[model samples]
Target: MVTMTSPAETAPTPRLLALRDAVREIERHAADRGWDGEVTASVFALVRTTDALSATPDLAGELPETALAEAASDPEHLTSIEQDGLPEATTLEELLAQLAWPEQVDGAAVVVERLMVPPEAEQGLPQDPEEAMAALMAHPDRTDVRLAAGVLRTGESWCAVRSRSHDTDDEVAGSPEAVPGLVEALRATFR
Candidate 1:
């Protein structure tokens, strides 16, 4: 008897490979920057049907103040994309549940979260996380707190670190992991 395996069983699809590669690069960067601690990464895919990734401005790109509300699918926050807000997340599951992805998705991104101070390490940690994050962002000393990565429909790839003080052009020793959780997350969605 002859047997044959499906495309997925035999080898990864193009989209899968793209996501894996993007995640790998991001993780490598994280590891190099020493940001790969016990932080739970909440991964999401902005999947699309085409080969190009959409650069369309969406609420997800907003800063935390507005981002938190928009991500929760609040209508009041739906006014515009110029607002910058970061979503509030205590748990990966909670973050995943609250995400407001576009109706059309074509790519995947991983969000690795880190606190300015560890829960146990916080001697005077701010009760509100937004305050802590804002404080970190406002410091005169700039640090790269890199966070996310993506493969767009344009076939363009990007890895992002959530540092207000740093630019994407700022080069660092990138040494992301061979595979990050984003791959599994995207696969779970499409498969």
Candidate 2:
């Protein structure tokens, strides 16, 4: 008579092994890049999983339980694995067959873009006036809209400074003294 093995006794599947390898590759890349800051942090926030087998709670685990537990509890490991970049394969079939999942890859791209690119107003602003405005407006907790408004206000003040300096022949348009007042004004608005 033939006997059937229980699910618990079954060997790990090839797909699962591939997935584990992909995760490991991502973690290695993240470590190499020193990606422990805002970008990786955001990626961790987005793709974090509660699965017992997928989490990386420990730095090194000799047993399955310890490894699984380590993965689950360690946000840094999970974030690094989820956010690391992947190379683009030639074909969709090749890509699909090679990686964990397309959704995970796409999510990582979104996190990278959001972290790397400054918002619209901050992009292509003039070096002296615009950069000064951006510096004046930046805040740790402010929303993008609020920050943009601050940028606009600072830009207007810079324009005024430029006009006044031109009229007076004082060259105060790009002077260091102008930045403090604008920065103070921006800080006051937040209050």
Candidate 3:
């Protein structure tokens, strides 16, 4: 599933490279903590700029995308949670844990990881990417089936696709910008 691009075309800028490193760091942390889940469900977001969003620290590291979206839907919820009180933010993870992202995604770094299942394979596909992967691996007919995913965040989603059964090693997938009508599609899925 790796996208074959010219070396010149695939060269990452310094910022993007740094972002990639951050994604790796976070992922390694996740793995160490046994946060084994679908890449998407385990999505993390951060502020692209160093500007602080709130009184909290400038960085919002390794947060669930669903939590980010839910908190954005209502500010009062965050206020109420704050009033209730939680752990003090002494580290970036704690900071992210304590804060609720408002209805603003501008300049936010999103890292998504999801399993891509084919229509034919949908019957067995599970909502959890890890489970889906395990099922896919066990299945006999594993061809042309891949997990289309967005692994890291660097303006565009950083792709890391791997084969379902044969090749366990992750391949360097292509860089694709946000897709048009994706929001609508997601909404429809929820409905």
Candidate 4:
């Protein structure tokens, strides 16, 4: 007789669960700040709780003894550390291309807002980057989107996207491969 496996048996690993939680936490934090339509992105570094505690001893005061003990012992536990704001003029791709993480940085995440239009709207976009952006922003059918993506050095990834039209916690969607390009870019920083 063969024993059958169910969907529950194929659940994501603990590391993935932690990554998802961290991504959502950051997403909600961004949402709390309210949308400002800023071009600069907010970036963060995800480190092991143990590492974060060691690197920044001040964090110890923020957690209770039991919580600190658990975080110190749980290798899968992670904490998010927001990095400096990106320069307004620099594109994410350009900034990502120049990034090299320190040894202690286990992963990285970014929250960015962009104006998106249907594929057809991009057909006649100008060749110049500035012109293209202006065209996209001026498009009548554009949608504002806030995307949060994170990647771990161990090859796990998570993404959350919230559109301004449905800007609610319950409406935010998340998945491992929801935004492949952003995931890939974040992963490159680990290398």
Best candidate per TM-score, number?
Answer: 4
Model 4 bad stretches (over 4 Å):
1-9, 37-39, 54-57, 63-75, 85-89, 126-134
The best candidate by lDDT is 4
lDDT by residue for model 2 (48-78), tens: 2333225443523433464446445653222
For residues 1-191, write the lDDT of model 1, one tens digit per residue: 11122456555444444444444445454555554465556454543312111244453354345434433443111111111243677765455445544545555456574434334443454789898667655654534455565544434334444443333434322222222443343334333
RMSD of each: 14.2, 22.9, 12.5, 5.3
Clashing pairs in 3: 39-113, 40-113
What is the RMSD, in Å, between candidate 1 and the native fold over all Cα?
A: 14.2
> Which ten contiguous residues of candidate 4 have the minimum total lDDT?
1-10
3 or 4: which has the higher lDDT? Answer: 4
Residue 90's lDDT in candidate 2? 54
Worst 10 residues of 2 by lDDT: 145-154
Runs off by more than 4 Å, candidate 1: 1-8, 36-84, 111-191
**TM-score for each of the candidates:** 0.35, 0.21, 0.37, 0.82
Query: What is each predicted model's overall lDDT from 0 to 1?
Result: 0.43, 0.30, 0.37, 0.83
Candidate 4 lDDT, tens digit per residue, 1-191? 11122466677787887788789888998999889745368889998888778878999998668657767667777788888755444578878867778888888888888788999999988999999999998999999989999999989999999999999988888888788998998888877
Error of 1 at 96 (Å): 1.4
Q: Where does model 3 exceed 4 Å of error?
A: 1-5, 8-10, 33-40, 52-138, 142-155, 162-191
Ranking the candidates on TM-score from highest down gives: 4, 3, 1, 2
